[model samples]
Target: MVIRLLREQEEETENRGKKGPFFLLIFIIVFLSIFAFVFPFFFGFLYILGFQKVMGCFPCTGQSKKRTESGVNNDIKRKDQKKPTSGSLKVNSNGNLQKEDAAKDDRLSLDARNSNLKDQISENEINGGTKFAFGELVEATDNFSSNCFLGEGGFGKVYKGHLKRLNQVVAIKQLDQNGVQGIREFVVEIVMLSQADHPNLVKLIGYCVEGDQRLLVYEYMPLGSLENHLHDLPPGQKPLDWNTRMRIAAGAAKGLEYLHDKMNPSVIYRDLKCSNILLGEGYHAKLSDFGLAKVGPIGDKTHVSTRVMGTYGYCAPDYAMTGQLTFKSDIYSFGVAFLELITGRKAIVQTKDRGELYLVAWARPMFKDRKNFSRMVDPLLQGQYPSRGLYQALAIAAMCVQEQPTMRPAISDVVMALNYLASQNYDPQTHLAQGPCGSPSRTGAKRDNDKAQIASDGSVRD
Candidate 1:
């Protein structure tokens, strides 16, 4: 230690006495240190401060940082949001990027979202988002009371919450966070799920990722999922008319097509089912619940290889047998969902004499025969749909359920076909051509109530 200290002292003394190259070298080293270690931060600070002052001169929006709204924007805020995309990169007169000045503001937004996710992670582990606080969620949800609860699923429960900041109502999905799938699901959502932009796909808002509680917040869907509307919900809700059913089918196809074609790597919704399809306030259909969604195969690779994952009854046969998932597999599942929408019966059910009755097995054969196809429409739909349209929809559904995924129509094709069905102008008077249902005395009605039910409008009674 003494030798090292003496060496340093001699070097300092030698440098102090030197007037030529040694002193010049010392001067260069000190100057280099100022530029390397100090100048940027020192100058950058002043630059940002000056930039902020300049930015402060701009109009201050009356909208508070803690704004909240439903999916719909209030009239005033919507007006303010409509800014002209002026072809200008915001910069200060000193040539510094304005983004730096607003770094603090951006951080505050991300921080609030992150905080919300953290607070809800304990009770639901769903990795919702952190913008909201535990107290905020309690206040929003009324402390997750029974009334705020929306629905329960295999993963966890969902609650309706109102965020004062965004002035928006959102669905908070609280999911189990311990399993491998749970964490993967969180990462998948954080990485891929977003606006999804397709008319048929659902919108995902921010998420929560605090501690052990995982929650996913989404735009509140007023009408809920087709699964509950068809079979589970209380009787108070209006029955899904034929037009509503067709619209749902068409819209869902459009969503799937957008994901398959427009998204960066293309996405495959592995789990497609009625339960995952949500309806907006106006009853437009949007496919939601992307926990099992995956990016499709990239260049040169025929398909992605992974362990099989998806619900039972809705899975395509080939996809189930092999761990291979493709876009067509999703279409196949759509076929099953189509049958569910048409028949109003559970996809898989086991009964006494009929050991096991799966919709695909029974509908496949019956759908081949026109008489049988007409017989399969839901009793609720009572011949309201045009027969030709029904035939086309059924044919598309049949094509989707083909044993080979490659043979199935692309979601785009399915979307187009369903769209045609949705647009068909089936006159209500056509039902009168089939006969009466209330008074059984008239045998003119095509068949019994047991026949695939038909609604007043011409849709897939089947």
Candidate 2:
């Protein structure tokens, strides 16, 4: 019984040892499982806390807040800056944006000014001229058709159009956007022509200003410009006779006289060339193209200071050199035009001979001698002009193109001389009766002697 009890005790001790190992294995397994699940979450929490602490310690958070605030302020500033006013913006932050804003402001200002001009036109402040619509002009010109094209000038292309509404034929000058003349010139022309009323001046019939299009309407000159008649005469066309030439010169001078003496403030005809002198039905000469006209200096001022602007050959030397424009400047240009009429040569001719290139330069030498006077007459005249008449005409042209502005004759004096010449009608029949050697007949000799006596008596000179 004692051996059996001892064996039971040993079995019980082995069982106890197995139970203790099993309990230990189960406890280790539970602890490992808990560590696997909880370790990741605890590490993540610690990592998040460290990341927050690092971000909080740096100044980037304040910088990010500032960037957001700056963006909002810029948005508010841009919205505030869009208001249009007379004063331009002064912004240092952005250059490209400032330029864009300035451009918008300029466009707005231009639109406002244009609106005012349109209102003035509607009120008839632009004289009795009509304000035409853009579409009307387009239709009248047949969409600026090539068939209706009359000519082109510095201003733009001209087209002959029949105004269906007014039952009037008109000459439409469409301004070139890329031309030297712009909105300022266009407005100046309208203002100048509207205030001027004279038979010797081309009438301003109407005008059109629409968006980018600018146009002027005038009474259609049937004979076109004097340049057409004088230079490049078409085939089988007759040259102007002595009387006709004198008449045109007198009329043009009278136009200048009216501008200088009649207008309240004298108007300076800055542009006076053959092309600007338009001929009417009876070859009546009238001054056109007042875009370059300027108001003369008032009171004691002797000359107007302006940028030198005119045809090169026709511009007065003093005006061209000094930019000091005077009424005598017009006189000088008139002298050039008269020279063109007398010689049928261009103001600046293109020829192989350098001596004959400039009409004034060529005529200056001829003016010094009486014998060269006949040579200066238009070869087209074929010696049909009278000797004394030629001398008197050259004298007038000579005094006109004097180097010194003070030496040039006034427009009134020029008018008197040209009027006398225009009245002394030249009979081509009487001219033809003279022999081939050009010996003066008794009547012709007597008439020449009388004219010489009269010219000597200061009728032509004064």
Candidate 3:
């Protein structure tokens, strides 16, 4: 009995020893789990203190203090430390914030060097003749970058610029120094624009005459020239609608009327073409590039004799043959532009109907036959114009392009006619059902309207 009790006690002691290791293992696991969970937060707190020390001091976090009080002075200090790479920021002339970096590039001075040229243009010639520095123009045009270049005109290269001082976008015409003719035009434009201010006329904002550089600045017209919309349209562009065309014509005529009748001396627009007529927003047209403008004959005189200069197909028959220029010559040119608008063809097109290369010649026969009036309308119009309106427009264009300048209607008369035409209503939904020639249930009309409709993005829709 004594031996059995001793064996049983030994067995119990062995089981207790085994159970001790298991409890120690469990204790170690619990300690490791607790340390793993709390270590992240403890390390984060230490790192934040080290960050505060590295950054000089801890930012105040108090509800009582104003929200901006802590960083107000700090931000200003940081800004002062950093040197500006462009120019100092300041409120511009138009109450807009912009960099005035042009001052750094103002290297040319107009004192004594071009005294003779300066004398030609007296201070009294114009009240406050805003003379822009060459540096300002250079900076505005980004040193006349190719991308900003608008086009090559009769004067020189034109660049679209943003004048920081004026806080406005403007078109800058820089003269070609090598061309002596450009110099005369530069002076003429500056003098003419200085005195003339009308809604239809392009406003010359300022001019730059530093050293050999001669630049004329004018307001930017976003829609570009009328010629651009008329010819060589880029892909995905719709043709100008008939109503828009009439409005442009009327607006342009008003500009000529302002120059011809409203001005005291009665200025004549010697150069009148689609290219010279610039369009603005909503296709509002304005006459531009007045380098070739000449004062009309005074009083009883009929014409002014000058060198023959203007676009080919647009010049009047009388002016082209003889150098005698009259207000009638401009009327003839306007007729050509009117014809182009009607035909949706250029005044001078290449290899187009061999003998009918000139739009005026091709349209002449069509005008003679009343039934052929529909043929003159632009196919791009998709037969959307009123028949009577089209006839009236064609009649006006025909009279303006008469072989005799005497037969041509005055610009005022033309304006009156176009104003009536522009007022005519057009219903595209109703017109689309008819043919291009206004004949009902015609397959040809439906086909043409369908093609134009597919290509049209509501540019012609009223």
Each prediction's TM-score versus the true structure: 0.66, 0.70, 0.68
lDDT per residue for candidate 1 within 1-462, as digits (tens), equals 999999999999987787677778999999998789988899999997887686566454333444423312554545544541112225579964333343323332233345453332222223234455556666778888899998876567889999887888988877765443565565466544553566677667776545566667788989888887777547676667777888888878877888888887788888888898899977788888786787798887766776788877898888788888888888888999998887777778787998878788887767544556566777666556555555666677777887777777778778788888899756656543222222223364543233343221212345
Model 2: which ten-residue window has the lowest total lDDT?
450-459
Candidate models: Cα lDDT each:
0.69, 0.81, 0.76
Q: In model 3, which runs have C-alpha deviations exceeding 4 angstroms? A: 1-123, 126-128, 178-181, 352-356, 432-462
What TM-score would candidate 2 get against the native?
Answer: 0.70
What is the Cα root-mean-square deviation between model 2 and the actual structure? 17.6
Better structure of 1 and 2 per TM-score: 2
Better of 2 and 3 by TM-score: 2
Tell me each candidate's RMSD, in Å, in order: 17.7, 17.6, 25.1
lDDT of 2 by residue, 1-462 (tens): 999999999999999998998999999999999999999999999997887787676454443667758766777877877762332455566542343454434332343356455442322333426878889988898999999999998899999998898988999999998998777677768877888999999999988866688899999999999999888888999999888999999999999999999986789999999999999999999999998898898899999999999997899999999999999999999999999999898999777856447788888866654445556777777767776677788778888888899888899999999999999999978654222333454444543532332132122432
Structure candidate 2, residue pairs in collision: none
Candidate 2 lDDT: 0.81
Using lDDT as the yardstick, the better of models 1 and 2 is: 2
